[model samples]
Structures are given as C-alpha cells and as structure tokens.
Target: MLRFFRVIAPAVLLAVTLAAVFWGLAIGGAADERTLLDPGDIVRYGLPLSRTLVNVSIAGLIGSVVMAVWALATDRDEYRIAMDLAAASAAVLTVASAATIIFTYIDVSNLAFSPDASFGAGLAQFVTEIELGQLWLWELLLGASVTVLAFAIRGRRSTLIVLIGALLTTLPLAQQGHAAGASGHSQAVNSLLVHLVGAAVWLGGLVTLVFLAKAVSRDRLALLVSRYSTLALLAFIGVAASGIVSAWLRIGSFEDLFGTGYGQLVVIKALALIVLGAFGAVQRQLLIPRIATGERGGWIFAWLVTAELAVMGIASGIAGALGRTATPVPQESAQDLVGSTPAEFLTGDPLPPELTFSSYFTEWKFDLAWGLVCFFGIAFYLAGVIRLARRGDRWHVGRTIAWLIGMLMLFYTSNGPFNAYEQYLFSVHMLGHMMYMMLIPLILVLGAPITLALRATAKRTDGSWGGREWIMWMVQTPWSKFITHPVIAAVIFVGGLWVFYFTPIFRWAMSEHLGHQWMIIHFLISGYLFSLTMIGIDPIPKRYPHPFRLVILFATMASHAFFGVTVMTGDALLLADWFGAMGRDWGADPLADQKTGGGITWGIGELPTLALALVVAVQWARSDTKEQKRKDRAADRSGEAELKAYNEMLAKQAERDAKVGPRR
Candidate 1:
C-alpha cells in the first residue's frame, strides 16, 4: 500500500493538475496570441504552467514544515523526511520562480531569446527596475534562501524561521497579483494570501502524509494522522471562506457566474473545494479513529488521500488559470477611473460620504485579514472554554464575555466605519489607534487566554509542540520574559506611541497596506504586554507589586497625556502631504482634524487607564485578604509560638541595653 501510494499519488496529482490547467487556459483565452506584441504560445502557456509548479512547490515546502513543527516528533524519521520534502520543494520553487521571471520578461519586452549584450542589459534593467520583475526576483531569492536553510535547520525554532521564510516568498506573488490596482485591492490581496496559505497547508500536508506511510510505526502514524486532521479542518475553513471572498470580488454579480470564463473556473474550483472538504471530514471523523483502533484502515486512508490530492490539483490548476483570465468586473486602475479625484488617485478608492453620526454606523470597509483574525480568535477561545466545561473544569464566565466583546471591538475597528474613514480622517485613525493601544487590549488581557489554553489543552508526551507546549515555550523564553517585564512593557507601551506618530513609520503605515497591518499588530501587542504586566491573570516570569503597577500606570498616563497635548497644540501637520492632499470636502479642516485626532488620543485613553487602575486596586485588596487569611491559618497552627519568640527577643534586647547603660 505504501509503495502504491508513493508511486500513484503524486502521479495522479500531477496528471490531473496539468489537464485542468490546459482546460482552464483554453476556456479563459489566456493562451490566445495577442494581435500585437504576441510573445508566442510557449511563453503564454509556459508562464501559467510554471506558476502552477510554483504553487505546488510552495505548498510542499510550507506544509511540510508546519506538519513537522506541529505534529511529528523532531527525533523521529518523520521530522527528517518532512524537512527533506521542504528542501526539495524550496529548490523547485527557486527554479520555477526563475522561469516565471524569464517568461514575464519575454512577455513584457516582446523579445526573443538571445545571448547578446543588449538583451542582457534589457533583462537586467527589467529585473532591477520593474515592480513585477523585482517582486519575482525577491521571490526567487527568498526561495533560494529557504532551499539552503531548510537543509540545515532541523530544530523547531530554526525550522520555524525556515517556515516563515517560505511564507514570505508567497507575499511577492500576492502583491504581484493585486498590484494592478483592483477595485478592492486590499481585500483582494488579503483574500488571495489567505487562500494560498490555507490551500498550501491543506494540499501539501496530504502529500507529506503519503510519503510518511513507511516513515513511522503504525501507532505513531495514527497519532500523526489525527494531528494533521486538525490542521486540515482549520485550513478547510480558511480556504472556503477566502475562496468565496475572492470569487465575489472577481465575478461581481450572480449572472456573471455563468456569463464569464473566469466565473466558470471559479465554480469548478469551488466544487473541488467542496469535494476536498468532504474528504477531510470523513478522514477526521472516521478513518483516523478507525486506524487508531487498529482496524482495517490502511487501504481506506490511501484511497482517500489519492482522491483528495487529485481534487486539490484541480483547484490549484484553476487558481493559476484564473489569475491569467480577465475578471468580469474590470480592474479599475488610475487610468481606468474616469475623472479620478485626488483621493482616488492617492488612496485608490473614491472619497466616502460625509462623516455623520448615522454614517459612522452605516459606513464599512471590511478587511479580510483582520476579519479572519477576529473570527478565529472568538471561535478558538470559545472552544477552549467549552472544552473546559466538558471536562467539568471551572472557567470564569466573565472571561469568556470579555474575550467575545474584545473580538467584536477588533472586528469593528478593523472592518467597520473607523477603518472606512481612517484614510481621510485623522481623527478616526487616532480613535482606532487609541482603542487598539489601550481599550481592546485591556479587555482581551482580562480574558487570560493563555491561562485558559494551558488548562484546557492536553499536554503532549511527544516532543511535538502542541498548543499547550507552544504556549509554555513562548512564556518561558528569555525574550518573552524580557518583553513581558513590567518596566519594559511600560516603556514599549508608552514610548512606542511617541516614536510611531513622530517618525516616518506613521507615513508608511498610512500609505502602505503591509505597514498598516504591521502598525495594528505592534499596537495590539504593546498594549497587551502593558495590560498583562498590570492586571493580567496569565502566568509570567515577573510581576510587580500592586503599588509599583499603579506607579507605572500613572507614569504611562502622564506620558500619554503629554503626547496627546503636543499633538493637539501642534501647528505643523505630521503627514501634510497625505492628509492635506486628500482634498476632502467633508468634516473639519485638515489642521482642525489633526487637532481633533490629538484630542481623541489624549481623552479616549483615560477611560481604559482608569479601568486598569481600578482592576489593579481590586486585585491588590484581594491579595491582601488572601495573605491575611494565610497568616491567620499559620498562627492557629503554631498556637502563638511566633508571639512568644518575639517577646523573648525583646526581653534579651532590653537586658543587653540595661547592661550597656550601667557600663557607660
């Protein structure tokens, strides 16, 4: 069975994927020779084919590393095999990306292959100067790095870096796909990223499992399968949700589902997803447990894996083809937008309607990335709480409510009216920033997610880093200890606010999508760290006394208030080019809006700060009460032995003092 799988599984996947790619290309007219500047059929067809290989290679590399980190023990053959898979996949990715760059150059420059100085110069300029070329070149470089790093790194920590490098290689592609300035550019890019990652992990994991059949013992194999099942389930959800979003963005309307070739390909891919999802469900619910029970599950598992891979190949192939196809809704670039306004030219979207109280509730610009984060954040936290309940372990209901509320707030801040108007309104941006930095983190810290996870998750005897193990590793690390320290957290929490707004980072965050995401992450983490130091219930390496915590809070408040006051009173516009050039006709004057933002920063933070202080005071009183009760119990057990010892010591001291006085 193992030999059959090793031979048949990859062959079936490759054959089906190739067939689907060609079929999709034929339907989408992606391979049609252009009336002008035609780069020949080979360049047209070869580009998508090479990209298909790139996708498959990315899946294999990232998926194998993820499986190794999460499921397979490092000391076993399974881990070694997974890393070998990653190295091999990285090599393929590097080669395929190079081919893609060459083809892209051929298509763009409309030049035939030649080994001349002119050709070389043009090619060099293309790779060095063009955005598309630079993106692919960076991908090739990262892929090569992963290829080398994957071979040497076997430990979980180092392997994780390799995994991150592998994931980074995909970012260029995501950016490349959406850099054309699609209508919902940010959403399209984020959805594609989610799709790529989820699909890669799901498909590549199955491929890795096929190769692992002979690598581990039967009992261990069952355990690995069970672990992989969990990953597959989560990947399925991500892929499905992201697929819907991507399709909706491209197709635009229900009628286009049947009207356009791109839509048809999307439909086919969606069906493939459904089929793959069904396979995953069966594997998780039936095959895995049956195998663990020592039932006749080997053939069943092999056949199921083969079927799923074949379907995944179809989905992967169609994905590449759809990229080349024209969307039903034409991608609106700056040139395409008729009479484009300054706001549209700069932000790539039209100016929203005037800001009003009702509009604040009505306006929305959903961010798929943060939307997923919020969704999964709530889902998994609830799952942990539910798991505790099922095991008859007590969990505080207030924590659950706090966590849910926090997720809702996160969703709203990132995806609702605040996000919608932030680009145009500095006040709105500052409001969201303050919430991200103080309010949301305060509530989220109250959830004590880490503590709940540690209690709810079962400990693994194997060396694999499960949820509990990963949590422990994170909190126990020296770096984690340093960052979570009360003083360090306070500095980061307070100092980061000043550094971010006063530096070029603020401009970058405003203009670039990636920088914007990074800003959100930094604020949330900094805020969480500070909140954790003050009143967090999670176990950490260090905790200050309540009095010291109050001091830190007060100091932070003073710094924060000073920063806000400076912003409010400043005459200069921080991002004058961006905010001043927006040409918005609604709301306050640019300078006045900047002042409003500063006011928001200074004022909105007080509520959360006061809440933190109150929580700290309550905890302090509780600590004192607990200490008093403990002392009372000790005194009762000792029957006033401590008091007698104290009296005896006082008598001796008095006697010594009298003797000394007489001598004097």
Candidate 2:
C-alpha cells in the first residue's frame, strides 16, 4: 500500500497541478478583455481567491511528497535513503515550477481593475514572487544533494550530475514577469516577509534535521543538529527583534494595536512566535549537549522537537494571515469579517464590543470562578517551575511553564480573540486554533511533566512529604487512567470540534455574554486532548500499544481533516453569522472562512501525521523490550546483590582497620 501511494500520489498531484495550470490558462483566455498584469492591478483582480486555491493545490502536492518520503524511509529497502531524497527533489520541482507558471500567465492590464488589490495584485503577486523565487535555491540544493547522494550510493558522480542538470531546467524558463511591488505594504508587511524567510530557513532546516537524524552518523549528526540549533536560535532572535519593530511601525496607536483588526491579529501572531522561540531556546541551550553525550535524557529531546515543530506550524499560520492583511482590501472592511449588522458591515466597523470584562464581572461569582482558576493555575505552575529549576532539576520548570502557557492559550485567550473577530470569522478562528491547538499543545508537550514528576520525586531522597504522595496517587488512579487513554483522548479531540460547530452551542456561545468563555473551554479541552493523544509529550503511566496509538493518531487526524474539508466544501452556512445576517456582515465571506479553515487543516496536518507515524514505529520496534527486560531480571538481580555484598565487605574492612590501627 505504501509503495502504491509513493508512486501514484505524486503522479496524481502532478496531474492535478497540470490540470489547474491549463484550467487557469483557459480561464485567462476566456476573459474577453486584455488581462495584462501590472503589479498595482494585482490587487484589483480578486486574485487572493485565485491565489488561495492555488495554495491549496500546492500544499496538497507538498503533502504527497512528504508521505512518499516517509514510505521510502520505512520500507525495507537497502537504498531507502537515496530513493527518498530523489522523491523529495521531484516533489519540490513540481511545486516550484507550477507556482512560477501562474505569474508567467499574467501580463499588464489586469492591475488597474482591483478595488483595494492595487497594492501588489492582492498580495498574490507578492507571495507568488517570493515562493517562485525561493524555488530556485531549492533547485540548486536538490541538484547538489542528488549529486552527492548518487556518488555516495552508486559510486559514480556522472548520473548525479545529470540529475542535477535535469533539476536546473525545472527552474522558471518562461517569461520572467515583473514581481509585485512592496511599496504599498505597511512596514509590518515588509518586515514580515523577511522574518518569514528567516523563519523558514531556521525551522524548516530543523524539521529536515529531525527527519534525517536516524540515517546520519551520530557524531556528525550531533554537530549538524548543533549548527541548526544555533541557526534556529538566531532566527528566533531575529523574529523577536523584527516582530516588535514591525508592530510599532505598522500600528498607529494603542487603538490600532488593540482595537483594530490588523493590529490585534498581529499581536496574537507575535506573541505565539515569542512563546515558540522561547521553547526553541530551551532545546538549543539545554537538550543539545545532553543528547550529544548519548546518554538517556529520557523524553526531553522528543518534547523539544515536538514543541519546535508546533511552533513552526503556528508561525506558518501567522505568515498566512500576514499575507491576508499586509495590505488592506478596499470595500472589504473589518466589519465584514466580524459580521457586524449590515448597517455596521456596510458602514465598515466591527460588531459593537458587547462582551467585555465589565459584562463578565456583572455576574461576579462565575466570573470569579474562572478568574480564580486561571490565576491559581498560572501561579501554581509558575511557582513550581521556579522551584524545580532552582533545585537543579529543569524538567519541573519546563513542564509547568508549558502547561501554564497551554492553559492560558486555550482556557483564557482563545475566545477573546475569537469574539474580537466576530462570527465564525475565518482569520480569527484560524488564529484561535493556532493558539489553542498548535501553540498550547506545543508548550505542554515540551514540559514533559511525567518525566519531571519522576525526577522531582527522585531528588527528594528523604521522601519526607506524604502530602506530595497523595497528589501523585490521585493522578495515577484508575479514573485518571480513563481520561488519559489514547482512544479517549482522540475521542475528545475529534468529538470536540463537531460538538462545538454542529450544535447550537456554537451559536449561543457566539451570541451570549459568556460565549467567549465557552469557546475558550472548548479550545482548551479539544487542544489539550488532541496533543495528549497524538504527539503525547507528557509522561504516560501506562501507554497504549504502539500500533494502537499510531492508529489512534491517524484516525483522529483523519476525523479532524474530514470535518476540515467538509467545512471547506460545505455550502451550507454552519453558523448563522457565517451568512452575514442582514446588517451584521461577517468580515470575510463564508466561502472564504471555509476555505481558510481547510487550508489550515490541510497545510498543518501532514507534519503531525509523519511525526505520529515515526513515534509509533519506534514504539512498535520496542514492543519486546519489556519482555526482554523481565527475562533478564533474575540474572541482573543476582549480579547486583553480589556487587552490593562486595561493597559492604570493603566498607566493613575499612571500618575495622581504622578502629584497630593502621598496621594491624
């Protein structure tokens, strides 16, 4: 089956892409008027819709390539590595060529017509130029990689060089059209582009490192990973520096930063990246050395990699949103996305901000309950973190911080942004999911709480506190078992999305004063459960079998994606606000909302799938380890007993000599 997929998937993807190309060209031809593309008119052509669809297709192709690579790696082939790289190169070529071709099709007159799209042809031109240009660099590397790989594998450079040359022709041979101008973009947009590229080089390289670690020499791999760690750290620092500067430059005032749509979304993006960078820093500073030493650092490396990957995914999401907002779309006011009453939508403002702290405080007790929960939760976590780190055990601090961040993201902030956007607004919802699903899971996974709990317990040699023991007992109880089961976790994750969306809960929550709070709860539960089930970085008391766990992850993700594509293709208005009720126009169209959600799911799903498969495969390979240990126990036990007796004999002899006199 894997073999079949490897061969056919890419072929299908390439076919779809070629079809889209011809379809686009035909669409271009059918328009009677000259559709010459100028950079300014790029925005006028309603090109984001076009660009987004293309994004969907391109992402699918990349996903196919990733799956193909995985299949190649795991297949029992001696030349697995060589085959995988060749497959990857081919995938990269297909995507890059197709992206560039769209630009070639555009000419000049198309620019003048866009309403607000004049800024850079609706940001499509901007993105197309960047991705298409970036492909050339990949082409070069693909060639170099093939050359080196062929030589290493086949003991010849000639075939490799020929492959490299063939890869070169994959570059844009068609007309090099004028790339979009960035002049109209706010400084934030300009800076974001630069940050994104830097981020891609850093995070994408890290991802490749994780995937290739098994094949590379351990010593060399350690050094290579260290280099990447350094690179990631630098990129993070750049993200922080550029992000803050860009924020200040783009936002006009506090209102713009907080009150306005662009600013608030940017704030969310910036903050998520900040948390992600901090997570990466821990990996670079702490884990790399320990891992290089080849000692068992327990689950630390796994947590670090998962956190980094999650961060990378969220960052990609932020980049997507940036493309949407770097320049405003005229006639598509903020009100439209928010689903303000038609009066408000047509007038160009968000739904009146009704659910404020004041409203929550009015019903003081319930509000107080939530307030206490978040406050104490954050405080307890942070305090424990500081205590553990100070005790020279970093795990406690790491896990606590991760849990706290995840809690805050899901239980508190997810909804504020959700409400702030109004309706099932696509961009805001994406941001919300990024927070709840991606960012929160990342932090929790990094914490590796189970391992931390064990270490913290071990360090206290005295075992003085029975109080801590009770808490530990409860955590390990059967009831706790039910909650943490992979199947249950998967159910929570897969079930939560639909329950929220399909039920009136989604509507009532959207309409009522406490709806934001409800949304937060939904996000937290769904996000945490999802993380716990699939990429599970936290300690597991008893885990499901490797095969079962893998199946669980795959199944849950499939569920999520099933809904996701359904959401995208769904013409039915799932949410009342999605239809833009009368005067209250949701800022973005329902179609756009559906489309954006699908894109997020489609783009982000592949990484998790691959990660899950690898982890599960590792688990499967180790299934007999427990039995082997049991069989060896008696012999090991006797050896330890003998060693213990020898140590005692030495201690006793030393004591006797000291008491009696040195010479005797």
Candidate 3:
C-alpha cells in the first residue's frame, strides 16, 4: 500500500487536477470559441491546463524548501528527498512557466503558429515590451534560477536563500491577470499573493510528506508530520483570510455566490478548503497521535494523505479557472476614471472627504499585508505570554499592554485615515511616517519582545530551525551586531529621513504600492534598531553607556528637528508632479501642506524624544543607586575594612608631609 501510494499519489493528483480543469473550463465558458480573433479551441483549453501545472509545481517547489528548513534534519533522508522534490518541481515550474508565457501570448494575440519574421518579432515584442509578457518572462527566469539553486544549495542559510528565490517567482503572478486592474488593485494583489503562498505551502508540504512516507522510519515520519501540522495551521489561517478578501473584491455581494459562475467557482474552492481543513484537523488530532503511539499504522496515514491531495488538486484546478472566468464585479477600474479629477486619475482612487479630526479614527482603507502583520504580531505575542503563564512563569503586564498598543498603532497607521489621506495630504503622510519610525517603535521596544520570546520558547535540539532558533540566530549574527550599534543605528535613524525625502524613493513611495510597503518596513526597522540600542531590554552584543546614550539621543533629536525645519523653510515642493498636481480643492495648498508636514515632523517628534531622554535619565539614576548599594553591602560584609584602610593611608600621608615640612 505504501509503495503504491508513493508512486501513484502524485499521478492521481495530476490526473484529477487536469480533469477538474477541463470541467471548470466547461462551466465557466473559458474554453468557448471566440467570435473574433479566436486562437482556436486548443489554445483556449490549453492555457488553463498549463496554469494548473504551474500552480502545482510551485506548491511542490516552495513546500519542499519550507519542510526542509522547518522540519526535516539536514543529515536525514527526509531532508535530502525534500530538496530533490524542490529541484524537480522547480524544473517543472521552468517548463510550465515557458509554456504559460507562450500560451498567454497566443491567447492575447490570437495569432496562429508560424515561422515568419514578423511573427517572431511580435512574439519577442510581447515578451519584451508588454507588461504581462515582462512579468511572465521574469517568472520563467526566477523558476530557472530556483531549479539550479535547489540542486546546488544544501546548507541551512543557503537553502533559505534559495527558498526566497523560489518565492520571488510567485510575485509576478500576483501582479498579472485580474489582480492588475486599478480598482482595489493593491488589495487584490496582496490578498492573492497571500492566498497563493499559503495554499502552496499547505498543499505542497502534505504532498512532500506523502513522498517521504516510504523513505523515512515510521516514528520519524510521525515527528515530521507533527512539525508540519504547525505550518499547515498557520497557512490555513492565511489562506482562509486572503480567500475571503479575494472573493469580496471579485464577487462584491453575497448574492453573487449563488448567482454568478465566477462566484460558484469560488464556492467550490471554498468547499474544497473546508474539506482540506478538516483533513488537517484529523491529521493533527487523530492520525498523528495514534501513529506516534503505535495505535495506527503508517499505511492508514498514507491513504488519508492521498485523499487529502486529491481534494487539494480539485481546489487548485478550480482556482485556475476562476482566474479565467469573468468576475461579477468589473476588475478594470479604468472606465470609472472617465470623469474623475486629476487626483483620482493619478491616485487611482477618489479623493477622500475633507480631512477632519473624526476622520482620523473613523475612515479606513485596510492594507491587507500590514493588517496581517499586526494581527499575527499581537496574536503570537499574546500566545507566548499565555504559554509562559500556564507554565507558572511571570511576564510583566505592562510589557503586554505596551506590545498591544504598538500593534494597534501600527494597524491604525496603515489602515486608518492616515493611509486613506496620505496620497492627498503630505501632512498626513508625514504624520504616519513619524508614527512608523518613532512612536510605534518606542512602544514596541519597551515590550522587549525578543526577551519575551527567548524566555517563552523551548530550545530545539533537532537540526531544524524553529522560532526560537531563528530569533537567536538573528540576534547573534555579525550583521545584527553592526546594525544594532548605537552610532550606526543613530545614523540610520537620522540619515534615512534625508535620503528618503531627497531621492526618487519619495516619489516611488507615493506612487507605487510595493514601494509604499517597503518604505514603511525600512523606516520601522531603522526606528526599532535605534530604539533597541537606546533603551531596549533585549540582549545585544554591546550598548553605549547611559551618558553616551543621552548624547546620541540629543544628537538624533537635533538632526530630526533640523530636517523638519529644513522642509518647512524650503520654497520648492517635493514630488511636484504628485503633491503639487493633486488638484485638491480642500485643506491647505500644496506648498502650505508640505510646510504643515514639516511642522508635524518637528512637533510630533519631540514627545518620543523626551520620553527616550527621561527613560535614559531614570536608568542612569538607578544604575548609580545600585552601585552605591553594592558598595554599602560590601562594607557590611567586610566590617568596614576598606574604610579603615583608607584612614590608615591618610595617617601615613600626614606623617610623610610633617617630615617634609620639618626639612623645609
């Protein structure tokens, strides 16, 4: 049974996926003959089929690397087999991406195969000049790179690098297809990327586990399965959440779920997810424990896994068809821009209502990527606290409150009116930047999350990387040492502001979604590192003395205040094309608004700076008190021996001075 399952399970997955693809194509009319520029039924049907291969291959490629890094030991057969699977999957991804690129061009161009120069030139132009074509070409290149790296890389750090490359192959997919449209474009792309990666890891990890069934000992297999269950749980959460966001963006209304073909396909996919989730619960609750305890044999586990993979195949195929099906809500937002203002035309969204005090709290435009980060940040921190508490360990309540407040601030900064109005208001954007780079990090560092995590998590003995192991590795690395230094951290904190605002980076952050996200991350890290160096309770290679910390703080504060003043006093507008051309009829004028932003930068920043200074002063005072207490305790222990020695030295010094006076 194990041998049969090992050989035929993957084949089963492939056959079911293809069959489901054709079935979905039939239901959605994606394979119907086009009235104009029909590329023939072969191209119409072949495109979705090839996409299924790409998706499955991606699952295999990414999943194997995740398993190898998180669960399987490097010296074991399980780890070796997982890497081999990654290599094979990456090779498949390369060919499938190539096929997808060709099929996509044929579908788009409606041109028949030919050997003529014009045809070759058109094909080359599509791949080189067009956005969709460029994306696919990049995917192909990334896949090919992963294929080579997966075979060559074996060390833990090297495998992680290869894994990152493997994941990069999926980014192009997120930016293309229906997700490329302007309306809710960022949300759609973010949600779809989240869904793709989550499903890939969850589905691919299980398939890899099935293959490992025959290679590893039963007990070892059970242990690996247990480790994988944690990944599956996290992946499930991400997939489920992102799927809802994706569906809402496309379906628009609950009624569409029952009415539209696209919505029906979503229903089918959702059902498959439910079934797969049930399979995960069974694996975690019933099968794994029983198998580990010798109550259930490994063969039963193999059959159950095969069934799970078949279900995953159905979901994967349906998802591909959903991409091809016409969405109930129009994916393209260009038509809505017909009579829009310059603001709408440029920002791709309507100008928000006039900024008000209440709007800061009431208005919201969710950022899915950062929303997920904040959610998981608080959830995991709370979970760690709970685990520690259950074990009769004490973590400060103040720390917990500080962490929650920081995460809440993070969520609000990304999703609240600050985000909604940032494109329109330079002041609001600058305010959000202040929170991201200073206030949020100040609160978060006080939480001492690294210290909490180190205290909370158990040390892993296996040759696999877990949360605790990875954290320790990050802290102790040479790069970490260099970055966390007071001087370097101060430089980054102070210098980054000038470089960002003065460079094209400011323009990119304003106009591009990915660039905006990167801006937040870069500033947040710079702030965190700076705060960590100054007042963080977390362990580090070194920290400056308290007086020196005061000096660094004062220097950074002066530079920050100078930057704000510089912006306020400058006559020229930054990103004149963007902020100047917004055509806002409400609020301050562009130049005036830019000045307001500078004022905000200068004004709102002082509170955190003062807080940092006070904390440093308090720590210094406590350090002195502790030193005096140590000396007093030593005097008590030694019965004032040091004090008597001091007096004896003074007496000898006096006698020597008298003898010298007599001589004079």
After superposition, candidate 3 runs with Cα above 4 Å error: 177-181, 333-337, 644-664
- Cα deviation at 556, candidate 3, in Å, is 0.8
Best by lDDT: 1
lDDT of 3 by residue, 127-184 (tens): 9999889989998999999999999998876788888997887788888845342667
Best by TM-score: 1
lDDT of 1 by residue, 1-664 (tens): 8767888999999898988899999888898888999999899899999999999999999899899888988888889999999999999999999999888899899999788899889988998999889999999999999999999887977788998998897798888777554467778888888988998899888889988987676678788888888889889888999889988987889999988899899889989988888898898888887765645677777888888889888988898898789988877675467788888777777889999999778999998888999999999999999899998999999999999999999999999998898889999999999889899999999999999999999999987889998889888999999998888998999899889998999998987777888999999999999999999999998777999999888988888899999999999998999899988887899999999998988888777988899999999999999999998899899997898899999999999999999888
- Candidate ranking under lDDT, highest first, comes to 1, 3, 2
TM per candidate comes to 0.97, 0.37, 0.96
lDDT of 2 by residue, 401-441 (tens): 56777656544543244434434355456555656664566
- If both were scored by TM-score, which would come out higher, candidate 1 or candidate 2? 1
- Model 2: how far is 284 from its true place, Å? 40
Better of 1 and 3 by lDDT: 1
- Clashes in model 3: which pairs? none
| Each model's lDDT | 0.89, 0.49, 0.88
